[model samples]
Target: MIHPVAVIGAGPFGLSTAAHLRARGIPVRVFGEPMVSWRDHMPEGMLLKSTPAASSIDAPQRGHNLVDYCDAAGIPRLVTDEDIIPVETFIGYGEWFQQKLVPELERVRVVSVDRKSGPGGQGGRSGGGFEIKLDSGELFTARAVVVATGLSGLAHLPVELRGAAADGPTPTGPVSHSSQHHDLSRFAGKELVVVGAGQSALETAALAAEAGAQVRVVSRGRGRVAFGAPPWEQPKLRPESPFGRAWSLWALSYYPQPYRHLPAEARHYLVRRVLGPLGAWWLRDRFEGKVGVREVARIVRAEAQDAHPVLTVQTLGGRTEELSADHVIAATGYRVGIAAMDFLGHELRTQLAVSRGTPKLGAGYRSSVPGLYFTGLPAAASYGPVMRFVCGTEFASPRLAKHLAAAHG
Candidate 1:
């Protein structure tokens, strides 16, 4: 009956929550390779859209921020808000945070998490805790489970391109999502079509061109792709949000707790639109002309021909255009569908109430199930859009840890 709190992920939310729980003298077990998603999925040489100050994992105690890690490790410090963070440095910083705080993080994969059957019956929620099984064949029970798995099972590829994209054992094919690539150099001397207007799609196109690929960005928007306003033009009246500055950004970033009080429709709308789509200001120099942008374009059909993709797109003014590329990269961002998380048993998934395919979280970030909780991107519907960024750990970690400590004590 010695059940510890289980944290399923070692990213910003999981690492920070476990640190706070340990600081409160609570027994906890954290799993997943530290920052595995950020390390493995993001393309090399890419820069973070978030500034240095906002790109930190929260710790209940000080001395664990990005600045402290940079200073301690003798890495060049990011001294100003204007400084853009590199992906590699952030990954290293996350490892440093994990080592210094939640060093007990297990690198093994979690196969499944199921609700243990109680004396009442299998569907009953009382008495028995969670039964967690790992890939290594080890099984453990937890008094409470915190799921902070970031966006592991949520890469979104558009249905239009799925026919040409093979997401199987060998993902090498005519189409793929941006998340699957770590090096853009693989596309060198080849025609590449990148979809979407967001940072991921735009940046990938830029990197592909820089790597000597014939790159073009195809955006579905009727308007030209946008870049963030220059620093001086960013108004001071609106404080910075995770994505950028706006009055609504100020409200959501400062008031995640109150976000639940707002109507579900309003919360969902803000999450979808606030951080809509824009390339970072620094990236425009490389992206503007080096990468061809087919704005006001939509893919009408995608098919495989000669081991490559041939796309027929509907352009603005009711014209049709056919383009060929060695591969199509869908940089469409993640969709938070709890059912997509196959690690959760069917019974557990069915038992939890849902909002727009995401788990409905209640007090202390707990899901509809009493002892199960969720955080990070999946909590955006219940918390706010801030949950999608590393900075959200500041609000989520301490709050969730304190609740778990008191509930289980």
Candidate 2:
């Protein structure tokens, strides 16, 4: 039986993978709301840390990039490497790319994916395909599945501020991650404490302040909040890329596959540090004096006191202080792990090898479970840090599609 390949997401990795599979004449089905995470999770007025050239979703064919979309949409096309990409524009471009290349995307939720029992109910452990159930009550059987559910179940919230709430514990709780808020206007007239010094944390603090919220950033790390240096100051020898201007960035960008050969400790280290905490260069001016930042401070204890969060913090000079806020936002970023994918069956997830909670992906991004693959951030462990960004799709989409096609054929 010739079964269609399943792409379990509609983000950059999912759409690009489906497009490549279709281009190669492999039957494919893609599920999920296109750019839903970006559209609903990020705050308004946030900008991408990636430059225009590296922000395009990879498509197998020509004329399907961010620049192409800008040209067709008549927006001022970003030409240089210095242009800051707005998140809204990027979301629009993603929708455009989805329409142009993978219009058949099913904008529905995939409720569950389990290994199907075939013949005498003994095939799941052998070579039986997968049973995919959709929220709309539709079901599908696919010979192969690409689990590219990007950052869906991976938002990391620190434990201390987990229960604080400006209103109360609702759908998202009192203290929530930065990914939970799309509109910062709701934060207006509220006191918000944004934790972390990363781009998301810094930008969210800036957005919250601009939206009329009294905001302060609580960074526990010793490193000061940094912005990418001016383009003119950058050396021509290394050049610039979205991941930053460094030899390691070049190595990771051009040699992701070989990166897997390095010691697991090294690969993991690079993944955590390569594109480490820093705000976008343009956001620096707005954040410096306008937003209050607490550097060299750590939250030693936290508690909720009457619809607010009270944080006990230790400053650089061995000083303890208390800061209260109506709401606390954890900008701690995402932590990718196969176990977080609740839709994936427990048996299937357990059968796959794991590294740092992420599925240990093989060549072409396949998992230990045959015919099951993972890409994007989940692939970062085995492939390198590049897989964590949208630019990695240029390498992953075609390679994964080719492997799946060959295996199917």
Which candidate gets the maximum lDDT versus the true structure?
A: 1
What would the per-residue lDDT of candidate 2 be over residues 1-409, giving only the tens digit for each residue?
Answer: 6788889998899999999999998888999999988998888888888877678888888999889999998999975767878888999999999998898999888888888877654322346689999999998888889999998989876665554543432324557778888888888898888888889999999998989999898888554677877666677888466666778788888779898788889988888888888887778888888788887557787777875678888888889899988888888888987778999988888788988888887788888877899989889989988898899999899999888777666
Candidate 1's error at 317, in angstroms? Answer: 1.0
lDDT of predicted model 1? 0.85
Residue 363 in model 1: lDDT: 70
Q: For residue 127, what is the lDDT in candidate 1?
A: 61
TM-score: model 1 vs. ground truth:
0.95
Estimated TM-score per prediction?
A: 0.95, 0.94
Residue 207, candidate 1: C-alpha displacement in angstroms: 0.9
Give Cα-based local distance difference scores for all models.
Answer: 0.85, 0.83
**Alpha-carbon lDDT of model 2:** 0.83
Superposed Cα deviation of residue 394, candidate 1 (Å): 0.6
TM-score of 2: 0.94
